[model samples]
Target: MFVSQPQYEFPFPPDLEQPGSQHWRMVELTLHAPWFLLTVEIFDAEMLDCSMSRTICIAWDYDLAEVLRGLDPETVLGIVCMMPAWASPNGQWSSKEVREVWMCSSPAGQSVLLVDPAGEEFDCGLVPEHVEPLKKDLVLRVAPAKPRRRPHSRRKTPPTGNRRSRRASARKSEA
Candidate 1:
């Protein structure tokens, strides 16, 4: 059956550098504390002339602290996907867009929620072996907790016992 696809617009309008010569290309997807920060590198391509072209690379870092608050870190996985989209020549939309896919995995990393480029959610039949490695590869940058200083002891040993012990030793030495 032949079916037409529905169009989807990006949440934000693409930045227009020139009047009608702006297009963005997805260069890289970086997950910094995937659970907290998601960064995507995009290159803006603009035609300078008939034979020359210029591209400016920019990094868009999204802070998910507010969005991902209270989520369990161990089971949460941030999937960054580059989606192909139709963009206008005026740079109102980029050719490619980066979207963050939030998913949960089982303790054994067997269960996973997968979201495709079309925003369709589905279950991946089996967990990829690399999922564990990918999770391990994540470098978490967090400040170490400050060491707690213990309070000083207030009880003091009685001097009378020490004096008696010293006297007994001296008497034994004299004898």
Candidate 2:
């Protein structure tokens, strides 16, 4: 007796067949890149002024690296972030801590721990050009937020010399 197996089919809807959908998937991938690199400089206690601790930081992001290279020296140099919101834990895209990017030939090869400006460490993965599309998305996604202007304070006129003060002045003159 011969037994036949039932055939199952997945409906490939028209949406899945479109090129735009494929591009969308590509863009979505950039949001979650798997490769990064961490280039850490030697730690200096005098420069850090905090409790005496020796720690070096590293960072890596393909898009982030390109962005850092393009940023003005004034933007990255000597900029101290008070409260850094990490992208790994906090999922915040706007981070001043990503100082530079280091590209590698593999996505999951040599790995190192990266310490953010906030002093939090995480393993950074470096990848080659396998995910260029995602880098574009990263650039667009991590654009700096526009500076918010503080509300101006209106100048308050001192209560036109109060009546009591005026009267006192007049009496002083008469005396």
Q: Pick the candidate with the highest lDDT.
A: 2
Model 2 residue 95 lDDT score: 34
Model 2 per-residue lDDT at 11: 38
Which residue pairs show collisions in model 1?
none
Q: Candidate 2: deviation at residue 89, Å?
A: 6.6
- The 10-residue segment with the lowest total lDDT in model 1: 166-175
Candidate 2 deviant stretches above 4 angstroms: 1-27, 34-60, 76-114, 127-175
Span of ten consecutive residues with least summed lDDT in model 2: 166-175
Q: What lDDT would each prediction earn against the true structure?
A: 0.29, 0.30
Q: Under the 3 Å rule for N, CA and C atoms, how many clashes does model 2 have? A: 4
Structural RMSD, model 1: 27.0
lDDT of 1 by residue, 7-59 (tens): 33223454634454433332233422111123312233564322211222322
Q: If scored against the real structure, what TM-score would every candidate get?
A: 0.18, 0.25
Candidate 1 local lDDT, residue 152 = 64
